[model samples]
Target: MYKIIIVDDEPIVREGIRNRISWADHGFECVGVSENGQEALGMIAHFRPDVVMTDIYMPFMDGLELSRHVAEHYPGTKMIILTGYDDFEYAQQAVKLQVTDFILKPITSAELREVLDKLKVQMDEERGHLEHLNRLKQQLNESLPLLKERFLERMATMALNEWEIRSKMAYFQIPLSGPLFVTIATDMDEWPSEDQGTDNELYSFAVYNIIQEIMDKEPDSAVFRYKGNKVITILSGSGEEEIYTLAQERAEEIRASIKRYLSVTVSVGIGTICRELKDIRHSCRASVAALEYRLLIGSDQVVSISDLENRRSKPLYDGAESENSLISAIKTGSPEDVDRSIGRIISELQNASISIEQCYVRVLRTMLAVLQALLEIGCNETELFGKETRLLTELYSFRSLEEIEFWLKDMCGKAMIGVAETRRNISRNQISEAVQFIHHNYDDIELSVKMVSSRIFMSASYFSSLFKAHTGKTFVEYVTGYRMEKAKELLKHSSLKTYEIATKTGYQDAQYFSVLFKKCTGDTPTEYRQKMMVDGA
Candidate 1:
């Protein structure tokens, strides 16, 4: 309802106008009655009426003067002027003041009703427009948070090959003309919470404010909320060095700003510039991978991929063959051979300039390779893990390859520790023979546990337990995992239909294949492919 004020010098005129007609019926509430324009202006400042009805002639000030003040100060308020004399000058003054309506003196009840009815119609129209605008605003407010969430989720999970990424650039409406670079801002994994809590809105708002502050300072730049803590800021027509320097400087500023407001440390990884959005994901991947180097560099630091050189380019060792022999000797449990191999492997890695971290991974890979080869040479699988198989399962989360190498180093030390107390232990060579058989026949759709058991001269039940013990996976799980990995590679690289890929992966049923793929990937194959395309676009 529009609040109304009545202003007139005569108390009777004010009373007549206020009590004569039904203001409530016309969607108005008469809140005040002022003697003149000055009093009405004071009332307006407090009550702020939507419509003001007043006489042109009054003490202290007049209706025309009040209308002028309302027009400037409260522009939304509408003014209706009242007058007794048929004065052309008064009418001209009301027109100049832009009063909404002009009613001559001795106002009739019917004339007043018509004016009020018209005012009600105008108010209704304005209300309708306001309601429509509010609906749009409500919709945007609801979707902005979800949009930010979906954008982050998409950025975090989708893995796009080069072609899939290019297609996404065309589909998702990202700007593709300028040089694009990705900046990844990722939070470290903290202690687990009971809620498994996710505050998409708060994090998104923080990221948005950080980007906005940067763009606010540098008006010429374009910044977008790419995904999660990651934001893409494109600076056009700039030199690479200047762009990089500016980004590094702003990253520090953004880090400080986020810390002040959110109390969380954010690490930023900057990528090399690419000319299109299609390759921006590659840049994004590069930025994220740079996080692996964060251990050497510190946290809350801005590390640019363009700045780091891979230390492995320089050779640290002479004989790759001797390193292999050293690795091989250790697996065979020959103390003399193990000593020779350990020394050589370390020397080769040290000479190669491979970080202890890199050397560790390389050593683990070498150890696993030798372990696999030992099974071929009739080593017992049961002899590998002792009594506890779960220890093998925990190896997946080991940080640096060096960590695994150190574990192996410790394993070598332990094996040496017990050499004097050891009882006779036979190596399990049959498990490796089964693994070899599976590797050769995994593509066969009709291959079964029965066939493999018969071929390896073992009972089905015994072979099943042995397979699980050796691989930390059941026979069925291992084959399925292997096939699905192959299936994914084909789906990514080839234009095969769902049925063809299913068949190629040894799944006879396409629907079943889709179900399994979705179960593992959290997206159906079609949805996965479409999303990959969207990313490329």
Candidate 2:
């Protein structure tokens, strides 16, 4: 109910008004009755009443004066002026104070009740309108994250002008104030499900959650999920080197956290730094390009575009195809393919009627390409070049084209050999690590080849092939054999129940474990235990 205060100098007028009306019926409660406006003001300050009814001619602080103070301090508290016929002029002044209504002396109880009823309806409508506005603000807040995600995706892919970018950034409350900006793209080495079926989406969502949690702690960094399986982050810093270092540190932290918490490994690719807001798209493109190099550098590590910048040079002629063929052959082809690819590149340069300087630049570009391919397979320049520290100066001193061709072919051959040997060592080490991981986590029911491969930072398919070649069995076969051997020891040596043995061996279903045990040993668990007990006795 709304509260109200009544004021009059005379006792009879105030008492009659308080007693005559059934205030509850009009949706108001008369909280107080005062002898003058001064006393009523004090009650108003205490109760903060919704309505004040006062006499105009009260001594020391009249009705108009009180209404003025109410309008200034408690504007929401409505004022009603009570006046006599001669005081009608004073009531006009009260109207300027935003008084609700004025009643002449001797107002009937029915008239007063009508005024209170109308005021109640007006207040209800205002309150309803206020409530509606508050709900809209709340809904907008709830959807802000989704809207910001869409905007960030667009900024990474689309070419937006500075004004459009800044305005949207402001609207979304993104804290990307960068004198220098770098973009980072990250994704799992392999999804939980290799086929990328229904479970892929769930795994990606979990990965995004981990990434978001870590990135949120970084200042001036924005993180959001891209497509379904990738996460994109933009980081801002004061200088190019500072931002690059920050990006690398954050990427490593994200990789480590995902590996630790989710049992998955993620590879992060960082783009070159850009200084302008509109150039963010360029950085984003560079980051994606860096991810493509994961095929050469191996996965589960951070790759930066700047690291390969020196190895790339513009093509002097139409040698792009030949260059690509040479790099590809060095990575995966036979020695004959490498020979053919180098011969083709040399043939093109020999046929071109270019000057000696152009020839030198073209040959140097090819050498850099070979070096880049070797680096991808974890081969260093010292391994390929040996004691020859100044390979560039030696290339410049060569006189005839034959000398250059021989040098090119020799480097390509070393690259091919290095690629093969490094890949072999990498595979051996990865398989060994996978086995050790399985040994430690064998009791986990959720363990699988995919999980173990991710922990070792290799793709599931590649890990499977390598695991078989090294261990002479498929991943499932090896893990099962080990678990079965463990289960047999438990059944024969201990008094544990069949179900308890099953749980200890990583099987959630005892019936399935029993069937598998019988299939592998030609005896059920209980029969095996009984036989072992009798043999021992």
Candidate 3:
């Protein structure tokens, strides 16, 4: 029920209003009675009454002054003024204070009840409207992330004009505003088996989570999954070189985290940095093209288009097809495939009817391709070719096509082998570091896979897989087993109570510790202590 306060100078008037009205029947209760507006202001502050009825003429403070104060401080509270016929003009002035209603002196209870009934309906309607607005705000907040992702994907694919891009970016609250922008594309080097549908989904989800978590730390960067397989990230900064460096660092961290936690490798490709917002789509395309170079570069590494620009030499004799086939074969195919690809390129050169000088240029271009592949796979060219022999000068001296083919085959074969060995030897040091961290921090009650993984700069999922593979137990199982062993030692040898032992072993609840102890060791903490003592005796 809404509460009400009645104020009047005369004692009889105050008592009559309180005792005469059946307040509960009219959906209100008379919470207070005051002799003047002064006392009623104090009552209003304490009870916070929804409706206040006051007399127009009262000692210390009048009804008009009280109405003004209530209108300013308690705008939601409905006010009614009681006035004598002589004070009717004063009642008219109270209307300026937004008084809900005015009753002449000696008013009937029926008239007052009608006003109270109307006020109750107005309050109920206002409350319902407020509740509806709050729900809409909550729903908008919940769907904000999905909406932002869709807007970013659209921006990356479509050629939106600058005005449209700016408007949409503002609407979605995108933080990017770039004098320089770079896009990075990432995907798993190899997908899980088709039959393991659930595992594939989990791995994809974990990869996205890792990228999102890392990108969240960098300002003006956004990461989202595209077409279910690839993750696209866009980063904006003030300078071109700074943004490129930042992108490379973040991409490498993403690659390492996925490899460390998921036990799987991912390839990252970075596009040329651009200045205009509309050209982000171009960067997106370039990044995907760079990802294709993973066939030559090997996986689980960052490949930037800018890095390839200086190393790659255009085919000198329209042998682009043959050159591409040779690079692919050397990186992925067997030794025989490399030999056949080289022969195809030589035949194309021989059939061109070009001069010996042109032939030399084409052959040098092919040699450059070989060198690029070797560099991509982290091979030291100086070691492969002795420090004394300049590869290009030696290639220039070779007089016959057959001689050049033999040399090309030998170099390409070794490059293919180098690529294979490098991939096979992807580092396992991250897992070792994770194990050391867990052992050192085992007594921390908040110790977790995420905490340990973060300490070693890896993703939690990747770290969990490596931890399981290396220790033959999940992170929680290993930590719990270690804690139980420590608890067992303390119970057997020390006089500490069970609760104290629980605290030492990283458990906050002694009762929970006792329960888990019995589950793991087939005896409660106290029981285990007694059994050990008896057996020793």
Estimate TM-scores for all models.
0.42, 0.37, 0.35
**Candidate 3: residue 327 lDDT (0-100):** 83
What does candidate 1's lDDT look like per residue over 14-39, in tens digits?
99888997888888899999999998
Q: Kindly indicate the candidate among 2 and 3 with the higher lDDT.
A: 2
The C-alpha local distance difference test score for the whole of candidate 3 amounts to 0.83
Model 2, stretches more than 4 Å misplaced? 1-318, 354-357, 388-390, 393-399, 453-462, 527-537
| Model 1 bad stretches (over 4 Å) | 126-182, 186-222, 227-230, 233-265, 270-279, 282-299, 303-537
True lDDT of residue 106, candidate 2: 83
369-456, model 3: which lDDT tens digit per residue?
A: 7788778877677766668967768876453566678888887877777777664444256677777777787778899888988887
After superposing candidate 3 on the true structure, give the runs of residues whose Cα lies further than 4 Å from its correct spot. Answer: 1-142, 195-198, 314-537
- Candidate 3 matches the true fold with a TM-score of 0.35
Worst 10 residues of 1 by lDDT: 418-427
Q: Give each model's whole-structure lDDT.
A: 0.68, 0.84, 0.83
Worst 10 residues of 2 by lDDT: 308-317
Query: Candidate 2's residue-wise lDDT over 1-537, tens digit each?
Result: 889999899899999999999989888999999998888878998999988999888898988899999999998888988888566567679778999888887888888788889988987887788899999998888688888999898998888999999999999889998999999999887655566445777778888888888888987988887776689999999987788889999989988898999787888889989999888888988887777555434567888878855454434466878889889888884778877887887777655544446777788888887777687778877876787667679777554555566777787787777888888888888888888888887889999988998998889998898899999999988988888999999998899999999999999999999999998899999999999999999
